[model samples]
Target: MSDTVLDEWQIALKQKKTELEKCQKEHHVESCLKCEKLLNCEMRETYVKAVYDSMSKGKGGGFEF
Candidate 1:
């Protein structure tokens, strides 16, 4: 959270819908263990946390369980 530029994952979070969908389509990010884009992506943890947090808080989505 500084003046430094945001990384790919941070940028993705800001564009959550498109970014997540694109990753899913291209890499099957959640299901693909051998995902190339995700294998070395530095934003992996932040991306996952952002997704789960969004679901639980109903910020961008919802979850029943």
Candidate 2:
């Protein structure tokens, strides 16, 4: 078992990436959607937004993990 503990940002980023894959269907992120905490998920709205912002700024699109 790996002991790697991902920080809040990393976790949020990973979740967003996964969600994006199913919802957005993109490895990277061209456009980010609002979370609004409607789902009452662990990832906060601000954190999700931050990840979305980072994904949008990435060079090109569809950044595979």
Candidate 3:
């Protein structure tokens, strides 16, 4: 097993990703774009938030490329 430890942001992102993938599988869709609940899906919203948080390391501000 890898000995590297994940930061809080990475851990949260991983958990959210797993949930999102499970939801996608249950819905039988490869992408959320094809899902009918794409607009109001709390799961997707949470996953998106997790993505942003992971990128920003919990820093609340605009992201730079």
Candidate 4:
């Protein structure tokens, strides 16, 4: 087994991903795009933020993509 530890941002991203998946399961949808609340979902918003934070390592910056 791997003994690697997750840092704060990764931990938060993991948590948000779990919550997002749970919501999807409860809604019986495979993707968030299939959900009606795709636009105004707080869960999705937080999850997106968590993803960005994870990519940026908590550093506030814009990507060049």
The models' CA-based lDDT, in order, is 0.60, 0.55, 0.96, 0.97
In the range 1-65, model 4's lDDT, one tens digit per residue, is 97989999999999999999999999999999999999999999999999999999999899787
1-65, model 3: which lDDT tens digit per residue?
99989999999999999999999999999999999999999999999999999998998798787
* Model 4 lowest lDDT segment of ten: 56-65
Task: Give candidate 2 regions above 4 Å deviation.
Answer: 24-65
Local error of candidate 4 at 5, Å? 2.0
Please provide, for model 2 over 1-65, each residue's C-alpha lDDT reduced to its tens digit, 9 standing for 90 to 100. 97998766567677766665554333243444453433664434545675755666433355467
Model 1 scores a TM of: 0.32
Prediction 4 TM-score vs. true: 0.93
Predicted structure with the largest TM-score when compared to the true one: 4
User: Which stretches of candidate 4 lie above 4 Å from their native place?
Assistant: none
Enumerate residue pairs that collide in model 4.
Answer: none
TM of each candidate vs. truth = 0.32, 0.36, 0.90, 0.93
Q: Which residue pairs does candidate 1 place in steric collision?
A: none
